[model samples]
Target: MKLARLGVLIDEAAMKRLHSYGLNVFERYIEEILEHAGAPFETITDIRALDDRGFDIVIASVVPENEETAERLWQYAEHGGTLIAYGGLGLLARRLGCRQRPRTGAGYARLPEFRSVPAPLRCLSAQPWHAEDAGAGAIGALHASSPQGELVGPALQTFAVGRGAIHRWAVDIPTTVVQLQQGTRPVLHDGIPAPDGTADIDEGILKADDDIELDWEWDREKTATGMPYFAYPHADYWREALMAHLVRCALAKDRTLPLLDYWPEGTGHVALISFDSDFNEDERAVVTLDVLKKLQIPSTWCMIEPGYSPQVYERVLAEGHELALHYNALEKENGIWSLEEFTRQRQWVQSATGLARVVSNKNHYTRYEGWGELFRWCEANGIAADQTRGPTKRGNVGFLFGTCHPYFPIAWCDEGNRRYDVLEIGFLTQDLNHPNLSDTTVIEPFLKQVAKVGGVAHFLFHQIHIHRLEPVRQAIREVVGKARQMGFAFWTSKQINDWQRARRTMRVTGIDAAGQVRLERGTVNEPVAVWLPTSEAPESIQSPGIVYRYGVPCIKQVHHLTREEAEC
Candidate 1:
């Protein structure tokens, strides 16, 4: 097989120093890796007149400067090509005119080692959108917040175009000394191979205890200021990133990337909690039950058919918890049910729950593949709210999906309203990931968030998931105690739905003097500190919630049967 060919494009700032904010040191590293990649490679500071006849993918990177310039680079991708960039997301999406801002600090990077998470986009981190020029099959890996305090994984994402591929990365560049690569791009090979790309060395650094050596060369070129790399070792790390991104462009795969799930703007704020069996699988449910029992907090549980160990379901129903059907076929993980199967399962659970009027439903694993048909079936049969989504599977699949809160929405986007409305309850972190999260930290981070906008925290704890951990009950007890202390109140799915009437009324009535723009629900003036919806600033705001979209100061309620005042 023949080797691949690539062209490197960078601004003038990258050429002077081999390792600076732009491309200095990266050029040397790029040369080494391309040579090692067993392919013809070329580098140019000017993108104007490059002969594009023989290259594969384009690599782009982010800096404290030149952000706007990055936008112009999309032409390369739009013209049936591929690209990679050194930028973080959430903020990245917002920056690219996605029209929405990040809320609270949702897209944060927490690397304890760095004492850093993508901190409020002062310079290091940013909210950017994917290049729309690239096709929708783009694979995106974002900065995941982990316990290491605040570290972003060297992540990578890719997409396909007409006869080409586009790749983007938040990665660590390669270098001659340590032979390292960091950022979000994937590593293809390891070592400072021979001129023809053969190897014999420990190249890159993976996270601790996971010895995955990096692949490629660590080429260091001299600069006048000697600050070729940015600050600290990060210079070398970024250099490695530039190389890895280019390499991915050279050897990307041919497959489809999953689309993220997002709620449409008009969807209201809602919460969905199912009262079902612990099956004893989830580690937190039992303790959660204990907590709810003590707090006397009412909740709705979607009882799973046949899976609900009869006795538990009876007790849950007797406890007066609202019962709804949680549907799933006989086979668990690999099961794919048809519309009939879904309908049958729902009816079976409804009968077993003994609720002659089982009017609500949520799906197990939140996977209702044919939701459109299922929701339609629900509407025809009197289901009120379809509450089957949250911090599902992996929480990163966030984008635009269509429902916001518990709303009477036109069910599926394309098919129009099918009668059954799907409500989107915001998500809370799963205990499995943050087992150390006592009831204290769980509510601490979310309090200021709720106090400001009144969104639901939606924490999940199964009896089993919680029982596996020590002092589980205390964690539950603390959460209940804190709710009382915070002066905030709780609302079940049904109650919150009922309250939207008053809330919406208050919202529109309190419309600010601005007199223009629309107002969304959860708008409050109760000493609220928001993650301002503009790229203005984030240095000060005691409140810690992150907002990904802007607000127009309308009160949090709906007035008459009509949309209110317009811009003057």
Candidate 2:
């Protein structure tokens, strides 16, 4: 089956509105969602090309330029192509049997059951619509508190049209994605000051052996930042829905488009064990390394250049562990770090480790402001991956951007939009964020979520803290033990980075009607998992790599080096 060619109508005016507010609104998020779903699409800016005969389906935000373009959209929908319009496009709404009501201020809505689970839908501002007529049905609903009190209405509606269909969404999906991507959340009035007398708006800190209590405040109106409110807890839900809807639309037009497998080689889940060399204590570092050695697990040590010594660097390399940089500001004021200083640190680490280039890094304190410049530095310096997207403190913990998967970070600038070459391997769980460092059970919930999604379970452990705090050590041990028992493949950060980079480069050049798939290009000498959307299992498998799973097609490329040649 050939891939469906999706046409996305770009609304210049709507894009301008987002850019005016320093947001990289639409394209990147849409591309990411589509790519993850294995859906191929192209952008159409000219309204003259909005013909029903041109594309299998056309998607446009409610903010169309003029009446002419809007009319063209109607014709496109009425003639014979699936039209998906978001927000309150009057013509599209009426055609979809939906009537738009008054605006419901920014709030969160409970999505209808997706994959048998009710996910939360967070919107800055939502326009409620309902399917009141036949030949149409509500797919999802938005639940919000309004002036008339609590109300529920269709957030997504579908209607059958002449030889085609119209899918309308009341919630602003692009805006939500942009907000989550930027980590922009409205300031909640429930503010608490840090011990240093600074305002700690969204940060929480937990000590070792402390009580485990989870509190999520959902008062929509109480925000200090004056920004529109968004639901952070289920950001991934909204993203998943956006992708699912795109796939559904494509399938409706043509069902031959194959769904991409999430993990490489159809592995259920992946685990990454990493340590932040924040403290320069060699003994503490040795203790942590000793534990990992006993478990026979290879971990990535993100070493601080200033805190690192020749002895420790040699020891880590000799033990068959991965070495990465923990880039930190040499002289810091207000958490800001200079690019030149970062380069100096990188050179220092390279000189000490005797490696010409480093592939991975995590910012000290995760203070990643001036990200555009920071990422530019990474690309220029040959850094391939980063883990700085994790929460800096306890308060801001939990899935930021709602995904545990790695993606190319979008760089939003006044000049234009660009995606960096570096991969952002996000940290899903961290030991310091919890109040009870000794409590290993806190991490199980995160592990469970990742397993449920077949996502990466990346853990962050600080060497100094783990050595000083026995509970932290215990917690790490328990989490690792449970994850092993659950069948997670433990990998170093570099290994995961290599696999993801290869996966992104890989392409399914062709698939025939008989379901025979062909890969034209991919990472050479690297293992990859190819997903085939067929009930009948695959036969006549051909590859040099070992097949971990036959049906789903998890293949490890034949390694040229001997066991002694490769790091153990």
Candidate 3:
């Protein structure tokens, strides 16, 4: 099989060092680009020879300002050459075409202090962004050093490439933290190097480009199916690297990867079958509850009680599983509940948990989005999470093609009624699959699949699934055992239960004339993203707000709604 050739068009020491880290054929001062990724190619190095060889990609790693190399490769050869250029990149962008993307996206974790572009290009691209055990990566940002003092980041600027198909910050992803002397490119966020000419992203932090590999270790644990679930995030290091490579590949000025909380994490997909229930107080609930108690596994219950069985619902509370008002009352109406009728059902939940239901309804028969009015009512009433976007009572799948996980609700618990305050937790599995174990006994396969996609198994197990699956129940114990053996951690659903609980407190305190935060409640262990209304600063929230009782920042924003609408 013929392999594709990649040209390394540089003679500089820096270029030589950089090429060592990449894969594929490296051409020095290659004249032409690889014409295709179709098949392997015979090797050729002469710059002029590139025209005849028909290579597809060219990696220009030298001082792009050097007109000789730029003119040769820039003019001749393949339609698009993947260029690893610096100065020449912007120039090519102008020729190849370019546009503006708002700085609002993602990729820039450490924002450069000054928006000003310095005089010289001197900066480090590597600075550790996480804890020591958090593994490591080659962090790159644009930095500059002046004839003056220390180096700092370049100013902020966005440039489009490839007819607006791609976007690059001129966004500095440099590893050198050296102070760049001005005359730098558009990546406005720049930083300068220290006195020593030595500047890597965070200067001197990274030594020997050979040791640099773009990989980060995710703290991993196993899902019930014994597949790995990473507790921490992967792709933090590679995502930006991949984006840069992608832009370089497109050879377009418009190429850009979102720095916003993008979806690099949810790529994997699958679901689990729960083996427990929360609605009835029959032996089914008792048997299922006993196993969950013995196994130390936390499950979610779809509770159904119209002041009928307080002990049953209360037992779910005592059993240590999440409680969602199961719509038994509304099941007859095609499992749909009227807003007011739904309210009466969960009215007794306070007796169970002593707190207003923070989570919403999960319809029985595994129906999805059945009780819309009930959900809306729950939302208006102080609830913030809903788990109804799964199989309806018919136990049908495939209506959901691929998506499975927690997503922001398109609307409140109400159909077609949107609310930003609610978090929609979708159901991935239920108890029916266990007894039917037929072909859809996807308990393990689904769990394994969901784990692959960085998803949680939001199961609605009834008393039957576990209590009956003698072997399967034992299998649950083994799954937990294997997880512990593999260094994975299991979290009680209530912990996340609380996380959803805390999200509602976010408020827009006051807007600056620039629309920056005059006030925002900086709570503990939460995602607090504050943006300038102008959108320049976007939304930036850091840990430790003024609310911190202990010098550490913590507290809620002032201003609370007088009363919340009613919910289950």
Candidate 1 contains a number of clashing pairs equal to 109
Q: What digit string (tens of lDDT, one per residue) describes model 2 on residues 266-362?
A: 3567888888887678898889888887877788888785566678778788887889988875334323366777788788778878888888998
lDDT of each: 0.38, 0.61, 0.36
Q: Considering TM-score, which of the candidate structures 1 and 3 is the better prediction for this target?
A: 3
Instruction: List model 3 lDDT by residue over 1-568, tens digit each.
Output: 0112444444444343444553111122122111110111233334455455554444443433445544555554324433343222444433443322222222223232211211122222322111122211122343322223322322222222222221222433321110111011212222232222222222222111112111111122334543222222121122223233432333232221111111112212322224324434466667767776776766656555532255655776686666656654334543443566556556755555465653655544433222134346666656555555443221222112122434342221122223235445555434433433212333444455444333445544556556556655665565555444433344334454454344323333333343233423223233333211111121244423222111112222222222222121
Q: Which one wins on TM-score?
A: 2
- Clash numbers, per candidate: 109, 7, 122
Candidate 3 at residue 525, lDDT?
34
Model 2 weakest 10-residue run by lDDT = 206-215
Misplaced by over 4 Å in model 2 are 1-3, 11-24, 61-64, 88-99, 130-135, 145-149, 185-215, 218-233, 330-336, 370-373, 392-396, 413-415, 432-438, 524-568
**Cα-based RMSD of candidate 3:** 22.6
Query: Of models 1 and 3, which has the larger lDDT?
Result: 1
The count of backbone overlaps in candidate 2 is 7
TM-score, one value per model: 0.40, 0.79, 0.41
- Reference-based lDDT, residue 478, model 2: 80
